[model samples]
Target chain A: MVTYPGLPGPIICDYLSREASRGRYGPGVEFQIGKIEMVANTGTYLDSPFHRYAGGKDLSALPLDSLANLDTVVIRIGGGSVRAIPRAAFQDVPVQGRAVLVHTGWDAHWRTERYLSGNPFLTADAAEYLVSQDVRLVGIDSVNIDDIDDPARPVHSTLLGADVPIVEHMCRLNLLPDRDVRFFAVPAKVAGFGTWPVRAFGVVST
Target chain B: MVTYPGLPGPIICDYLSREASRGRYGPGVEFQIGKIEMVANTGTYLDSPFHRYAGGKDLSALPLDSLANLDTVVIRIGGGSVRAIPRAAFQDVPVQGRAVLVHTGWDAHWRTERYLSGNPFLTADAAEYLVSQDVRLVGIDSVNIDDIDDPARPVHSTLLGADVPIVEHMCRLNLLPDRDVRFFAVPAKVAGFGTWPVRAFGVVST
Candidate 1:
């Protein structure tokens, strides 16, 4: 489901096939019921605070205590042509409510076209210093943490205007470590919706 | 995003609006980039085994250790007129490799029409006794594990034909606590998608 170069990708067919559920579960009983349309920013997503506040908090007002398990902190910032990323690169982490994530290895230009143009963002003073250190999530292995020609996204308007929760097209993050990571990105609570697509994972302490 | 009565429900518009991002980020900067179309089994979901063996394994071959933070077990079964269930209601716990939820509190008839007529499931000899006790995942708080008027799903063809993964319409499970539960239902690794929709959570040890 990795398709986001101007969205609209993900149409996985079959709403009951396998020879049509073997004619409604006959033969040695069959099953399959896929169906999807998509464009909540295609892959690896997660963006609550109603995707930039309109009376914030959607995706069913987020809380499973701020997504699955949380309490993570990655930071690294390795990989070429350093683009922006200020606030003294998150001043040696201990980022408040944790789930900092920024390992910029831009997911090795995932699914090409150089991952939608020379990206690597986050710097309205690193989103106002991770929303003045009350972070509960903010991820990015690239592709828009703002600076897609800066349409004044200002790091998604200062970390979704402080209700936090971001997580972009992330990828491994060099196998997470640097703080007892344990994040998890859930979605599909959908109430008046505001950004979907997530299966983000993290959980290390090996 | 709770459709699935003949599918299609989730059209959440807005592909960058907030008065069109304040005419492209002018004013005190605005943002919103939503867009969704539905059907991946609408609301609560998960089921890999290519959704039922075509060559099995889908959702990008599911592993974040069998869908996030395992070791769970609820099995309460206490709703009215208990439908099916069996395998002696999971004969005194210790369900081999965890995640065997089934708290038929039928989610207090979730979004009504009695959550689609007569809803508790999981029989086929309790899905072949949790696929011969190798359960790594299998959830339910209602609305299907099998027995949606027996379309011969055979507990979803005997636990997704032994690749074992299935979570469906789950709700709190009467606030879980019958085992050190810590489940988490993830989805969106979509490869020919077999099912989607999830925000199913669980984690107890208070």
Candidate 2:
């Protein structure tokens, strides 16, 4: 039902399962699904402060309001040649106390080798600007909000250090209006776990 | 920042770890701190069909849409003394194709011994009525939507078997207006896993 124009269908990475050969519950079988088998961060994900800060709240300590019912505003910075979105891009949009979802439309490359290409991203200044605005959540339709190829990764540090949750690998932003939808990207609650996969989405009134 | 109005506060739990003694890379030491242990269903959680159905999509196969961006309407029953919500209670509510959030104010009992006793629940007929309305999601603020003591769990079957996700252990329904908010309850994508905790909340326009 989610149709994207000018893009291939959404790619859902098939979840792989490793048959238990031996484990504690007995030699017979033990299904250690999340912990042992998959990447701690995969699919759509939420990055918490623990991902960047030394003494930050793990997934368990993340406030429920941090991930739920956030007033969302999506900024459309399209036209193929966007390298990094600047603070000026958000000039008239309200950012305080809301989830700022940047619709880059880069998730169209999910799962394919192209997903890792030079996708649109937020500038370091833009991230600092968001934190200055007291944004609760920042989400992107790209591989990562930080330039993945960048060794410094300023976006992750600026945002996560402020305890602002970031959602990456999001699909279907094309279905959303630029400024009216509600965004949610809830991470798992584990004492020491900070970054983990999440099923993030937006709800708009009809 | 999430100050709960009453007793249990918010039963929504969180777990995030970075060092693990056990996992896929195997026992001794692993760099990735996976979620090694937690209640299968904890915090704000979801009850998928596989939680109760023998042949159903496990947590991994469940569609992302089932847990995301649901049009929600909270029906506030049990104003004072009423405990059981019957099918007739929802006759006037617009339930078709929406997430029906039943707020019983029982979230006030979370984490206390009192939470485990005499919880309000929906009747069997209420479950049938919801299915008839083709509801996308069903949620409640209690520990469980049905009387957990009831071995049959008709509400679980009728709703989950229809592939409708059920969110439990929510707090702060008192803060939301009945019909204007959108609810989101999302779970992790772990293949073959039946259930996991969730952070469910509603969005209201300011």
Q: Estimate each model's TM-score.
A: 0.36, 0.67
Q: Rate the local accuracy (lDDT) of all candidates.
A: 0.79, 0.69
Q: Candidate 2 — what's its lDDT?
A: 0.69
Query: Which residue segments of model 2 deviate by more than 4 Å?
Result: A1-40, A57-109, A112-123, A129-136, A149-151, A177-180, A188-192, A204-206, B1-40, B54-85, B88-98, B113-119, B177-179, B189-193
lDDT of 2 by residue, B85-127 (tens): 8998788999998989888888877777767667788898999
Residue runs of model 1 more than 4 Å from their true location after superposition: A1-45, A48-86, A89-153, A157-178, A188-194, A197-206, B1-8, B15-19, B23-30, B33-67, B71-95, B99-122, B131-136, B139-144, B151-196, B199-206
User: Each candidate: RMSD to true structure?
Assistant: 16.9, 9.2
Model 2 Cα shift for residue A88 (angstroms) = 7.4
lDDT of 1 by residue, A107-131 (tens): 8888888888769887788788778
Residues B1-206, candidate 1: write the lDDT tens digits.
35445566667778677786687665677767777666667778888888778888888887878888888888887645788889988978899988788888777777787877688887899889888989988888777777777766788777887888898888867767888977888887878777788888776767
Highest-lDDT candidate: 1
- Could you give candidate 2's per-residue lDDT for residues A84-146 as a string of tens digits? 889888768998888998887777666666677687888899999999999998988887687
Best by TM-score: 2
